[model samples]
Structure formats: structure tokens, C-alpha cells
Target: MSSPQDPYQPGQPGQAPPQPPLPPQQLPGNSGRAFPAPAGTYPEAGPFGLPGQHPPAKNRRKLWIILAGIGGVLLLVVLGIVILINVAGSATNQARGLADGFTKMVIGGQSSQAYDEYLDPALKEQLSKEAFIAGVDTLEMDESCKPTYNDLQVSTDNGVKAADVAGVITCGGKEVDLAYRFEGTEDLKMTNIKLRPKA
Candidate 1:
């Protein structure tokens, strides 16, 4: 049999081969077992990857939904503004039409007819046909008094929508400023009329 210190010692029956010696770095201070080597930097996007930065599929979908919600709100606001503008414009035109019709009557020698047919009920009660005709006549209203309607402005007072139709009426050889204010723009009626000679 080989001696215990023999180089051929492993020739003994059932004896395993000797293990290679660990490196000096592998030694655990006085402890029989060695500690494992320190690990290197983490794998690509491994532990350093935060939750929502490059996010999972589900989180990405949530972000898209939030964007869509904002887009929908903006679309609704634009549509509402367009619709409001159209309604206001229609109201102003309707009120202007009423004022134009009344002005035409006064210019066409039908002041009494206009007062009976177009004036608000409350105003008609306060001013009789004679009084209304007398009012129009004060401007020396005549065929030579050419009326041209200018810009019509709009406003609201006490929940009553109104329009002020401004125009120049040449009367008695003088240019006069004419303002016809109407109320109830929805079902417009002449509320007031005034004529002033321009300076």
C-alpha cells in the first residue's frame, strides 16, 4: 500500500481525489468556510428600473386613457363656444330685422300703423297713435329723409336681451343720428326710438 503522504495516495480504495486550494482572496478570516465573491453591477434595467418611468404595459395604457380624457374635455369646450357664438349672432340678426321693419314703416308714411302693429304692448298703452305719429313728425320725417342703418350692437338688461340699431337719417336737410333700441331678442319688439340732429 502507498504511504499516506505519497503522491500516489489517491490509489487507496474508495479514496476521493484532493481538492485544489482556494485563492488567498477566498479566505474567510480564521473561519473554515470562505465567503462568496461580491456581485457586479445589476443586469440591464434590472434593479435600477423605477415603476412608472418606462412603465409596464398596463401602466402605459392608463397614461393613454388620461390623455384621451383631457382631449375629450377640450373638444367639448370648442364645440360649446361655437354653438354659443352662433346663437348670439342669430339673436342679434332677429332683433335687427324687427327694428328695420319698424323703421321702414315710419319712413313709408305708416307711423300710426307701425305703432299699432310693432310697438310693445306696454309702450303702445303709454303712447297713443296720435302721440306716436307726433313723435315721428318732430324729426320732419319726409321722403327726402333717407335712412341708412349702420352697425347694430347687442346687450342684456334684467335678463331681457336687446339690440341698438344705429343709423343716419337725413331729415329737414340735416343729418340726424337715429337709434332704435329693441327688447326681447327672442321674439323681438320695438321698445324705444330716438332721433337727434348731428352737430
Candidate 2:
């Protein structure tokens, strides 16, 4: 008649031994990633909340917008330069056309009209109308001198000011080179003219 020995004691094993502390109780409705894990849980709280988290997504978007704006500005600048070059080229071509038309008129014996219409205003001031008529008459007297179109070249020195046109006129099997400069905004006007006989 002695007190019953504890059944769970090592040598008195008649009752079932305790099952491994019930395998660490998991919090209900949690994926076991909950912060401050439940009491007697296996996982412990790890990292704490950081103050003022960065908006990485928003920052990335802003950076892209800035880059796009810069690119757009550069593109517009390039386009402006191209447009300016085209405009200058057009002006040069127009100047060459004017020179070609004037040369044709003079060679076809319409010297009077050429002298009156194509001469620069400054040149007209230097020579009287009578002198121009006399000079044209002298040129036309060369019956053997057959004038023909040779070549035309156009160039631009100052895009804002004027265009330079070079024209070659073949006469009597020889070449006569001339330079014409044009100025003005909407309607370009002849500003100067120079003639040279090519040997």
C-alpha cells in the first residue's frame, strides 16, 4: 500500500508518454508569417517596420518622364535646324532661277528688257538708261557671238541676308561667267551683279 507511482515516470510507464509538446501551436487563420508570432510559436518576429518607405515605382516613372522630355527637346532642336537648312537651300535655288531667266532674255535679244528688269537698283543708279541701251546694242552687234546656256550654281553665305548665284554663258564657243546676289524677304530682289569673261 504505497502511493501509486507517477505513471509517466521513466520506470513506471503504464500510461502514454506526453506527445512532444503538441508541436508548437500555430495561430488560427494565419499563414504563419504573422509579425510577433503567436505565443509558444516556432517562428520569432524578424525585421521591424522602416520609417518612410520609398516609392520606387513612382520614382522610376518620374525618371523616365524627365528623360523623355529631354529627348523631345533635342528632337525639336534638330528639326528646327533641318528646316532652316531647307529654307536656305530653297532661296539659293530661287536666286539661280532668276539668273537663268535674265541670261536667257539677254541672249535671245531681249537685252532692253533684261537691262531694265534684272539690273540691281544700285547698278541702275550707277549707269543711265541711255548708257544701258547703248551697251546692250553694242553686245548684240556681235553677230558671230552665239550665246548658249552652260551651267548654273547657287550658294548661300548668310541665310538671313542674301543668296549668291553663279551662271555660265557660252558665247562664240567661249564661256562668260557671271555672279548675281539677291536680297529681300518674301520677294527676293537683285542686289548686285558681276560679269567675267573666261579665257
Candidate 3:
């Protein structure tokens, strides 16, 4: 018989004694929870518990909206510039047309119409219309009164109301001086005109 202290000596035992089963693992706070493997693949979390890459689409859309707004502003600026240029060009053309018409009327012996168109309202009020027409008609008859105009140079300062015009006129084979003052509009009315015989 085996001694009590030697429960089953290796040499005398028919088989090894059975071992005790291990205790179950305990999770920290939540006892029922199961831990995943450290290297396992899982969805990533981003700021505010949102998916990491989900906001890219929204960010892209916002960027496009901003770009479109910038483009619209640029388009408006370009359109405004175009409008300003066209208005300036139109004003210049109108001044030139008035100059050309005045030259034609004076040179073609249409003194009544020319005087009516060329004189400022104040000047016309000072000189009777009939008297002004008669004077221009007589002047047109003078062999020394043949008038020719050079290119019209038009400019503006404060607006269409403050335009200036200057050009050369040849009368009686002699170059004369001509100038216009815009009064409340760009309709260049003749302000000062003078003629002198060629030296």
C-alpha cells in the first residue's frame, strides 16, 4: 500500500492525477463584455463619433459652392466693366456726330440750322434767332468764310455734363480755332469760334 504522504508516486501511479480546470476570465467594468483581437479590422471613428471619411463628400460640395460664388462675382465685375466701356464709347460717338453735323451745316450754307444748333441757349437768348441766323448767313457768303473742320477731340470730367470738345477749323483757306462746352449733357454746343486771315 502507498504511504498517505505519497498519494501517487510517479513510478507506482497507473495514470497521472487529473488537473483542475482554469477560472473564467473577468472583464473590467462590464462583466458580460467580450474583447476583440487587437489587430482585428473595424470601422474607424472620427470627431463627434462620425465615420472618419464620411464628411469628405460634404466638404467637397461646400468647396464647389464657394468656387461657384467667386466665379459669379468675377462675372459680375467683368460685365460692369463692359457696360462702362460701352457707355464711354457711346458718349464719344455722340460728341463726334454732333461735331460732324455742325461742320456740314456751316460749310453747306445751312446757316439758319447751324446757328440754331451750335449756339448755347444763353447765347441764343442774348442774340435774337433771326439776327443770329442773318449774321451766320452773311458770314457764310464771305469768300473768306469757307469753314472746314478737323477731327473732334472729346473728353469728360465729372460726367456727361462736364464734357469738353476741341478741334481745328479752316476758314477762307486759313486755319481757325474752335471749341465746345458741354452744358448739362454731352451734346457739344459750340462755345468759342474765331477766324483770322492766313499770314
Candidate 4:
């Protein structure tokens, strides 16, 4: 006798064989996540060599160094600016002090001393000591006048620094405006002087 009817055999006339289960990708309600591969098998390779691998450690370190260098350069630039500002301010104050001293000496009847010590080479070439003294006597400034400066400024050109100071000197209730230009901060010297009666 023949073997009992094989139920799942293909080409069997009566019954159709059962189908295998569908892959996860084709399954209904699947979230599209792939199944894990067997051990020793790898997933798709990415640009960085592996799917979850990071960039090389050397490259990351280089990036950090570059950023730090930029930060250091910026810090140095800011520090340099601060130092330059301080230097300029110091020079301005020194110039102002020199100007005030010269004015005070001249008003105190020390015109000879003021001219000898404070006059710049350029000014001396233009005005003799006698002429300067004569000019001061013309003003007839009171020896007790106290000078008050209202305008002060400093500038630089071609690596040379100069200061301009304008002030009012009150003598015997009469006010006179005195303006001066001083050159060279290190050894300050009066380059020009203007004395006019206050109107």
C-alpha cells in the first residue's frame, strides 16, 4: 500500500501548503526597524567607517587647539589696546602739567625762566628772549592770577605728539585768554603762545 496522503506536499491536488511568515519589513504595523544581524556580522558602513563611530581623536584635538589659539590672539589684541590707551592718557596729562607750569611761572614774573626752560627750538627761532619778555610785560598780567583751563587736547602726526591748551587767566578782575601749543611729551616745550584780552 502507498504512504498516507502527504498534506503539505506541493503539486498535491486537494490542499494548498501553508506559506512562511513575512519578513519584518513587509509585516503589517511594523515600525520599519531592522532586525539585528547574527554575531560577527556588521551593519552598513557609514562615512566615518562605522555606523556609530566618532571622528578620529587626532582631528578633534587639532580642532580644539585651533580654537584655543584664536582665543589667545584675541586676548592679546584686547590687552594691547588697553595698554595703548593708558599710554596716550599718560602723555596727555604730562603735556597739560608742563603747560600749566609754564603759564604759572610767566604770571609769577618769571618770564625769563619760563622762556629759557619751556620754549621749543622752533619757537625760540621765531622769538628772541627779549621779545618774549616784552610780550609778557605788554599783557601786564597780575602776579597773583590763577589760571583755569577750559580746553585741552592732544594729537599725533608723523610719530610726533603735541598738545593744545586754552585757559583764562584772571588778573585784577580782568580776564585774559591764553592759548598754548606744546610739542614733545618726554621733554615738553612750548611751540606757540597766544594772549588775548577776554571780550
The numbered model that scores best in TM-score is 4
Separately for all candidates shown, the number of backbone clashes (residues 3 or more apart, or on different chains) is 0, 0, 0, 0
Best by lDDT: 4
C-alpha lDDT of all candidate models, in order? 0.76, 0.64, 0.61, 0.84
- Sort order, lDDT high to low: 4, 1, 2, 3
Q: Give one digit per residue, the lDDT tens place, for model 3 in 19-45.
A: 664223344564766665345556568
**Model 2, stretches more than 4 Å misplaced?**
1-55, 136-160
Q: In candidate 1, what are the lDDT values of residues 61-86, reduced to their tens digit?
A: 89999999999999999999999899
Clashing pairs in 1: none
lDDT (tens digit, per residue) of candidate 4 on 1-199: 2246744667767665687866545665757766665567676787888787877899889999999999999999999999989988888788789878998898888999999999998999999999999988888886778888888888888777888999899887788898999887467688999877889
Weakest lDDT window of 10 consecutive positions for candidate 2: 140-149
Ranked candidates (TM-score, high to low) = 4, 1, 2, 3
Q: Model 2 Cα displacement at 150 (Å)?
A: 10
Error of 4 at 177 (Å): 1.1
